[model samples]
Target: MAGSLRYRLQPIRKTKMYRYDQYDHLIVKERVAQYRDQVRRRLADELTEEEFLPLRLQNGLYMQRHAYMLRIAVPYGMLSSPQVRMFAHIARKYDRGYGHLTTRQNIQFNWINLEQSPDILAELATVEMHAIQTSGNCIRNTTSDELAGVAADEIIDPRPYAEMIREWSTFHPEFAFLPRKFKIAISGAEQDRAATAVHDIGLHVVKNAEGEVGFRVLVGGGMGRTPIIGSVIREFLPWQHALTYLEAILRVYNQHGRRDNKYKARIKILVKALSAEEFARQVEAEWLDIKDGPATLTAEELQRIAQYFTPPPYETLPATDAGFEGQKTDNKGFANWLKRNVKAHKVSGYAAVILSVKKTGVPPGDITAAQLDFVADLADQYSFGEVRVTHEQNLVLADVKISELFTVWQAVKAQGLATPNIGLLTDIICCPGGDFCSLANAKSIPIAQAIAEKFDNLDFQHDIGDIELNISGCINACGHHHVGNIGILGVDKDGSEWYQVSIGGAQGNNTSIGKIIGPSFSAQQMPVVIERLLNVYVQQRTEEELFIDTVQRLGIAPFKEFVYASPIPTGYTHGEDACVY
Candidate 1:
């Protein structure tokens, strides 16, 4: 690895292997051979860049600012220990010694040679994973809650349905060349960890009056230049009709979705233009033809898919592990971890632990190669040889025994993975920004770094309470700025970097878009503006009121008054006064 900051920012490209069955192995092996030939032909000028672009993108290859970047699918954020180890292995062997986890729960290798991509695809195919449908204007990786099966409030496991959609949409002939990319998210829990409300098509598992399992489907919800929470189209859609209904929605979008304007190509725009009711009627009309068609999920196939995600044979344990108390009494750091990272598991003695990536001053959601290996080892040691990547870009050790949590925490902490700020203000969600992305308007990473540095005091952060601060380099909203309780968007004002702020947005069960507080602030003024906003919240908030709640009750007026009061210069200095932004 190079020591230069530019080199450190460079992406890695590695060969990945998948865990495949006989049929899948054969198909992927053949596809690799085919792709290898395609690569050769393209290199030989048999195919033009324009013609080869889509072909390569469909295989997860992108010609980025620096090099060809490959995005590998981690379907529904699920990964076995073996899969995780393979990812670590690829990271170590490739261009760099690390990989980046995306907002979509996929892993991206930022540097690769075009000639080596087929070899990489071949390696991934061996592990039952691939970059297929990771790019291009088609249904991408179907995401779900990381806590799908184990959450106490879950109605059903969503992975089987996610897998079903993955299979149906992979290389679907009609949707391959749609106007724009499509994303679908499913959630089984009452909590919206999957961000279902912000997807192109969102499905929430539900049971109707008859106690029959089905889907409460919503359409046209997405975050970007136009952010809208999905509107419910069907109160109850039978479970078996998942594929058929989704196909109908996609077909309509593929035909009528905007192709003339790239900015408005998303299906969310179409849904907005027609209204949710009109979109529903259009889908209903289309579904009439495919209701009983081949795309309808079959019971036997669903059963087979469900088997892969069946709960591990967990041993019964006592409600409270006696060993845990002694461990907590001995270690303060471990105790703090238990307080912040652990979540309630459905099983009594088992715990789901969130391995926070939001360590102060580091880029949020970043894990090094060594850290990845350590997590793999911890998963194998404590969990059921499995790990899950969260929508928030953290790792989850889902089946750790309460008795072993102390040991797990110690190991995680040693590897710099035990940041005790899961949903705190410092746990910012940010995109690659101007540092790596070609589409960025300004650098988001530096802004996040500045914010984290200014708020490094844990007590101050806790006092400010839970705030979802999201930053996006551009209007695409990959960092989910629209739904952040405090959103920051990077915009190019002339040639300088300016950030627009929004407040009161949320993405849980009660989803709402953030409202702009006032005018944009220059990068140098951002940290001060944020401080003023927090000061306003702290002063106006009643007992136990969160930043969001305070804003909701009193509105953004008080915060606005302080933020716009002084009209600071572009490179303004606020003395040594931390409170006066």
Candidate 2:
């Protein structure tokens, strides 16, 4: 994969998202104005809490522990440099000085003053971004592989299709009020970085036997009190039929999904109520009417959307760059960053660099205003003026030249983003937990910090290799606890916060739900328990076998025995409200 390097001058697209037409702009403007009036009414005591709750939620405003929180959609996780700067401005002005990235690749601004929310939405509209469809019982932000367009193993760039769906789902009248919230995730790559298997609908883009592009669609997957991996409802659906088929599935769920029990309202429960086979049969029957209707895609429409996502002008260069290789050889730190943060790109000599927001001692996925503004400038200079948010809670520079990686690493290191811990144990995916989330059963950030501190040695983390540690403050599984190789769920017993540990879980093409290791442990005991489990993995594992692979081979029995057999459980306090170690 080597050749002579040549300069290729190309123009960068000013935008990566679906270009908003007059209709799109008008719709958003109308919604914002309506919400502004609604807020005024509520403030004037003309509206009650019951009257205003749904209105605020649909606009992505949530009343959290501290104040109103705003969730902004990063459509398909794509952001331009200008949009990034807007986020920085909003963070500094409307709320705190930082924003938290979510597992769904959305951004949450905490401490937002309720009165200023309309203004925030107004600002977002100018950037072709919004808070609509990000909350409530409708289609949430349609998540996809963070490396949607450029991943080496991608079948087709999924962003175009994701944008199509985004357009269809936005303000969809029929789905505005469903039984419960619904999420959809798409994966274009051979590997499933989007964690699609745990969403309400998981869409895997595939090429069929005849080389026609299509989707292998999964349904009934969800995480919460009952975590269920999705079942493939369609082995292969032609690209044109995606919308119609989706409509059928949603229509069936909307009609028959349990509304009496909000607990069982998710489509997953419906799939369980009737078998997956039955569910598929029903969907097929329902799809017959709508299959070739107005909703069916035209090739021209697809091309129009795809035109927005064309690759930027890439240089004709050898796969291996001398400067990149030299830096890797000359500096141990630079070598580590390359191995961890940098990922292979489909285009030769271009690599995707992940800027880890999960630095040691910081809350996972949290980034300050200044840091985001810095990233915005870096994107303009180094990454074709674009950025992407990853489901793993990190930011990605999707198109950095291999030759420039060392220089980029130096700058990134200065900003403390050059953490050589990508895909490692300490690069944790975590939710806000009890610290900021009223829904959390216990705090998650401190536990993540403790584990990261205990294993801060990069050499040890690299040796451990590619372990995913995900933590959720409660069963809502906002942090995707059910899908991590090592999953930590915060549990409340009586009144005290106790942590439950699970192993063997994973999120990918081979997704699985983890099994619990027995009773819960206190916060102080969590990191120690984790260390002991890692010790078991080290002692029992064959060389280079990933932790999840080893767990699958040996089962949780051995790890469970090591943690519980220790004296900590015996010495631990058992009071209803004690925080005893």
Candidate 3:
């Protein structure tokens, strides 16, 4: 261990850790042992790569171009300070000192050795966390609104339902060997922060007219080769019948979902082929048998689960703190941070603060281990020792006091997390494109970086206000490009990276897929095209108009003309002269 050579040859160390309960510890220990055995068998050539693929993927291990990548699930995007510290520790110890927060609300550490994966999983389990079901055909992490428990608009905290789904789906016997991976998201608030509409199954917890709590279920929304908005299968499914109804939906899909063609295998395709009405009828028919059966949730069981997610005792504090007002009046930066990052919390004194990971010239959602530790400390100090990961790939301090806003802003700014660009043009949602993903047709991170760099001015971003610029590596739409106000899809044109642009997409209540404006642009021309598109909106829009609203009114024609009329030379043509910059 004295010399560098000796250090390099040192055996990897496994550390024992603590958890809240015996079941948590026991499960993690068993899982580690199981995975270690799996790894040993694979290395010994007993398990073929094909056989080992699903096993590894289930444990959140991916064999990438250079090495293994491990995705750690942040269940419902909720994390304690200690859990986050453990994440930082793992990132620093096992892999590079950085982690990527994925759109699915998980953190992925690249450069993990195959040998070290079991140890990592062991470490994660100590914090009541694991990589299980992070990937593969079984239900993935049951995501919910990031501000689930704390949001003022919330009818009910969706975390309890999410956790129920998580447990039920963990080792679901029948649905485990499905045709493709399934994703489900739940939201309880009026504002659909969970992007439930775009998920395989979107559950919206609501109170029906009869004063009964139930879910308005939407099924078949996905963003792979064919992106489709989920269709509403049930306008109102009784709370007690949640599981039985879901089982019915899954059973129908498993039986009839396409298995012949991988591209056409998603539930979305099935829904389309059968039509939403027919699919709904089939699911209803299947549910009739299972309704009021063992799968039906009892009030006691629901209450028992709800107990775990009960809100922490929050003291009544003043709505406006003098200190916060003074700081905002004194410091312009603090005021800007308050304006952009802080969201209203249900409690009087508390505010939800969005930590923008979208810094200029950096890949969005990429945070260093040191930064993770810094955020964990901030969460402990200012917030209530909790952090939430947003679907848009941002971190949120869900319970910061108004009195501590300035202090929180200072700490965040020091760590480069206070970009004051949340929901702005610079805050791009992008995927790990050609750099890491084998499926990508073109590079997405670079395009995101380029846009961020191009629109560095905070004032300019503010003027361009609330624009969602989403980029995908391919048509698979991992970055949710289809729902962005301005969408960019990467395409391969004779081997070069070309980007197709779309406009008028929105993911909120008025959700719609973006319409393609015209022919694709070279990577170099994308920024210019986006700029021109924005310029057209700025020139033509009425006061306080958003990007989508402008596009909806003018249609894609104006934007298309502006984009293609002066196409950049060396970029694809729409049969028009290149516009002079």
Candidate 4:
């Protein structure tokens, strides 16, 4: 809430993980200097708004509904304690006293001052962080699994590959200005935690029959006005050619992708227009020309990148900690927290913990400056001084020792970060909707608040079991409503706000889009409508069946009929002609 930026910039802290080379450091410093001058020129009435628009966007500055929003990238969702503390400082100094974590693994401050934007970038540069390629019609942050290195189901770690892509895509002259913003997500885990099926390119790390690691390539997957899942163009692409192959895909897309219509500029539209088979053919043809060019990933280069992501020096100990087990047995609250928030790590003596930011009454993914500092302390004390930001809008202490689980849980709970709702309906993934973002049709935070309040009973939420309920302010699908088991999308009818409901959508290996259930509803009717849909699911579900499976088995007819059983309002209708009550 401070209006003046007074904090002195600190010396850059040295980080062992993801160390930026001299070139990386130089790029960030030069960018900060350049942006500072740009701000000066704009303020002096030398640069017009039109002249400054693209320049400002290229640095991750956006003019939101109320103020400038600065998006800071967390490459592959990885963050160190010092870096997080910097975020807290920035939140308290330059903007409001909080930051919102986005679905793309970035943190956004919604109340930034235009003049202080350069200062913010300079502060971030002190920590080897920047906002480059975070906006504009360029390659955005390349996301990967939050549990990239330590997941038990992982065949190979994806962070090194993600880093490779980040290095390749950032400031690439040829592809700097694409048809539209491009996004890529890679997953090394078997469960697909990164939501790869919804990205422009989804790379799954796997092995071939000869026991050589490679990638399974998927192209043209996206969610927005047109929500289409990606199609697999190659079942297996050798690891050595990953970058070259990506270049080929981009080259093909660049050559033929539509540039006139911004609405239809995403690679998904092109893939659909050309057909997946034809698209694959074009990519392959382009790839032949640069199959083994300088961009080809070699074993030595991979090892160089992999060194930064090597596991921390972990203590050798028994898998089960007796103290932790006894504490779980004695405390029901701790037990519930463990059941929901704690996850299995590949190492026997360690576990991964998700510190929930979706507590009742708080906007999902919004963390205060004080809370950020608390998480930093937890990271330093128990989790190797590092944390990860999840695509689902939560933070993870990925390397917590098993013996410290109870202590970590208690610390987090005291700070209101231990909501014990990881995958339940209350653990909603939502965007900063009409409240902050200029593009939203309706307010999304209030809807999430209403639903979380309605399901205030932990016992009731636990009974409902694992389910995904996502709310997006608009069809941009930044909230990923299309893939939730129950999705809520805000829409505009005339001059009022309404919501459309969908069922049967899911993410992961078997990803599918949800179908619209019926007519839109008023804001006040949302909780009850959701209650009706859950009522149908509860009544029709077989023993211990998850929500998605039940929907897939019984179909949406039962749920749709149950929701629409009541008489339609006097002037209300479905689809484009519908009237908001």
Candidate 5:
């Protein structure tokens, strides 16, 4: 209690966010104490490196290429201003002066010291945060849309359901160890902003014709060594049975999933090997046993969880703000930011704003301690002290008033957080790659930077239109290259880094994996290869067609031809399997 963190500042008004209860506090505090002892024993040479590896991993501490990495979970991407300030504190005091926001809706301190991990956890505990289940063979963070409660197109607020799943999965005895790591994503919006299709378990909130709410469940979809889109196992699962149904699926996976090979251990492989129909049948049989068990959610229980996600208090105002429109009309930069970064909100006078972390030179999701602190200040002033971390590695102020758009834009621009390229080609989703991760085959950040530099012009990026370009340093697909409109995968060929290019991949309602254009390219050739692919798209695209639309219409044939049309530049050979001209 002596070192407990106290909130010295508060938001102007009450906002919807999950608050910690006594049980949550007890669990986190106990885990911290246990982990502290584990660290002590390891330091005293009682536990070997091999013995401490899994223990540290379970607490979200990884020994990376350079140093120990501490991953702190931000459940469903929700972050209070106070929590963010604590992140800044950790970044400044424990790790480097910056922290990286990961695609899993978690934050990572890549330069952490092994001995300071328990201290870091202790600091996070004060803010009601932890790193549990962030690693190891278990269910990782349950992510959802950043604009969950505020999205205009939302069917239902997904935070409650996501929170419920988080509660059920955390420290479950049966799932303490699984065949491999599992990921789950839920989206209630008509547009699948959460990229649920490529998760182990994808839950889409839907309403039946009878006006009953339920989930459309998809299983076994993931992007990794073997990228496959998930198949829908259930058309409609009643909300009450969500947990029981999830338990059934996990049980089926736990029993049948492969253990001999780590590569083949994910539920996706099992679902694919057994076929979706067979897997569905197995899950259904398992579900029947616990159909109406104690896990069944009641109306009262739903309300209790749902109340935490209720919309914040809002003042009555017209949908359009005249002054905001006039400012946008006068300033081209502000207009572009408004068009690209701002999204419609459920409330008439409110909007959801994406603060771009994809600045041209910066790593895709890296934010400095100063920026984090500034964002906390901004959140307190403009967005009710709440910020959301997007799965695409951006931050969001979910409840900004429409009239305050210009002020928010100005403040964020001064902080280098306003890049005005949310959905553009330059707005890339990239992994830390060989720069940090021991598993990475190549450096992903440089490739992203190369592409961003080549296409540095804002006008050019805007002209090219909305495109999702994802880069992964390895086949692990942490950057989710398999689902990008244009996917770039870093590979090792003959002990050198090469990139494999894919096109036509997409997330959302019509999720599909990208097709390999032809062969892998050298790191130097990645930018050129992307340019050629874009050239094909620009030349062949019909009126107003997006890059993905053009790829779908023309297929990979045209793009492939253009990429390989020219002779291989001197001194460079495609991989061993490539057809060298």
Candidate 6:
């Protein structure tokens, strides 16, 4: 993998990708050139880490525990096969053989030479991608549902609005140096699959009594040292005024969000301090003056941008395809994979397939260069050359034809991508914790792997139903542990590592933070703890209820007793009063 980094250094190849327009290319190109100069200046001792830190961060470069990590944003979590191949190229040339896909719909290359980062950015620019605004105190990538346009339950297509936000927030003059980083997520479906309630700003596409589309805006929701649910500021804002309203919100946040303390600088804190109603009043006042200004969206402009996201040329067919059904019945493996990985699509005779990267014993979201190329090939062969990255750290072939489902499943299975665990407990969302991150209090990957191995049986997982098991190395909540149906956080007491458990936390229509069960336990006890929780759910659940439903119906009290009944005598009970941040 070391020598392979010199993969011909080919010029970036263009593909049929959405939102990679001339304007995008130009902006990325110029930013790359600027960063290259900045790197040169730093190497020449014209700047120090303090001076060069922000410059590197805005470009998505981070000084990790071992080396620099570059986060490449996949705007709206959409990508093309050609762009994926470029990722493989970067993996071979500049870093290791694999990259980590993040919960925020981006990829992180963990091993990179600071000197060659500019060259890597230049290569990315050729393919109409960059690391701009992927980090820093500005609006990060605007993520939407992985199944946005193709979802069977979508009310509106969110890609266009997400892309618009990406453009507006990229290096915006007034917001570039905000008090804290901001994340925005939009969901156009009835179910909140995008975890919008946990973002800095969450927008849900809704319809007014007039039958016109608008946005239901929520502000201040965040997870970190302080996890708080966002508050609704606007019940209904016209679609055209979405951008202007967002600008008003940001302006108020930028002006008043505390900068003296980093922990309290997020817009969520500001909104909490001012009260949602007061914040709304201030933003409304600010919005009235510039509601119809240049940033206001126009109808023609929306349609123009939307054209890029229109569904592919789907073939008209019957509601049920005989061949697809026959293939499913004939092959048990395909049947299981279809039952888990394949989801109904808006288009008849088509399905959206999730490529599970969370296979047991493997790091939840790690994929190698060779596997990347293979998945890229699969995307080209069956999904119109497009792929979507899920917030769960998996990939999706969102528009696979039902007739070709068997073929796609076989190909992916051969490459170890068909784990048949989507939405299951083992389909864990994990982070590169203490193993790679400097901020992690404990190692996350190993704990996740341990739990995954314990519950690796497909039959057992299917019986458990949907469970969102998320783990984070620290309270930073990068793994979004707070929102997982079963959340685990790694905490370091003195020098030993232990994990704390939470229950009933969930995302979607009924978003709520999980309640911590009890004292932290050793990493080895994670599987036993999770098993006890599942056992309690199995015993108490009525009919065929889901995990979250069972937990909600019978409060966390039941499971808390099951887990902490005979506490392990490790003396890690200091967590009794520990804040579940």
In model 3, which regions exceed 4 Å deviation? 1-21, 569-581
Question: After best superposition, candidate 2 residue 540: deviation in angstroms?
Answer: 0.4
Give lDDT per model, in order.
Answer: 0.82, 0.88, 0.83, 0.89, 0.90, 0.87
* Per-candidate RMSD, Å: 6.8, 6.2, 7.4, 5.9, 4.8, 6.2
CA deviation > 4 Å runs, candidate 6: 1-17, 567-581
Clashes of each: 12, 0, 1, 0, 0, 3
Candidate 1, 205-323: lDDT as tens digits: 99989998899998989999999999999989999898889989998999899999989999989998999899999999999999998777767767666766768778899867668
Candidate 2, after superposition: displacement of residue 581 in Å? Answer: 24
Off by over 4 Å in 2: 1-15, 569-581
Model 4 over residues 206-308: C-alpha lDDT tens digits?
A: 8999989999999999999999999999999999998899999999888888999999999999999999999999999999999977788788778777777
Could you give candidate 3's per-residue lDDT for residues 12-50 as a string of tens digits?
222111123454456567878999999999989999999
| Residue 382 displacement in candidate 5 (angstroms) | 0.6
- Please provide the root mean square deviation of candidate 2 (C-alpha atoms, Å): 6.2
How far residue 128's Cα lies from its native spot in candidate 4, in Å, is: 0.6
In order of appearance, the predictions have TM-scores of 0.93, 0.95, 0.94, 0.95, 0.95, 0.94
lDDT of 5 by residue, 159-216 (tens): 9889888888888878878999999999999999888889999999999999899999
lDDT of 4 at 303: 76
Give the TM-score (vs. native) of candidate 5: 0.95
**Candidate 5 stretches greater than 4 Å from native:** 1-15, 568-581
**Model 2 worst lDDT run, 10 consecutive residues:** 1-10
User: What is residue 404's positional error in candidate 4, in angstroms?
Assistant: 0.8
TM-score of 6: 0.94
lDDT of 2 by residue, 484-555 (tens): 899999999899999999999998988999999999999888877877788888888897799999999999
User: Taking the tens digit of each residue's C-alpha lDDT, what string does model 6 give over 1-581?
Assistant: 01111112122333334545555566678888899999999999999989999899989999989999999989999998989999999988888899999999899999999999999999988877889889989888998899998889999988878877776777678888899999999999988889899999999999999899999999999888888999999999999988888899999999999999999999989998899999999999999998998788888777666766766778897767788888878888899998899998998888999999987878999988988999899888899999889999999999888888888888888888999999998899999999999999999999898778767778888888889999999999999999999999999998989998899899988999999988898987777788778878888888889999999999999999877776543332323322111
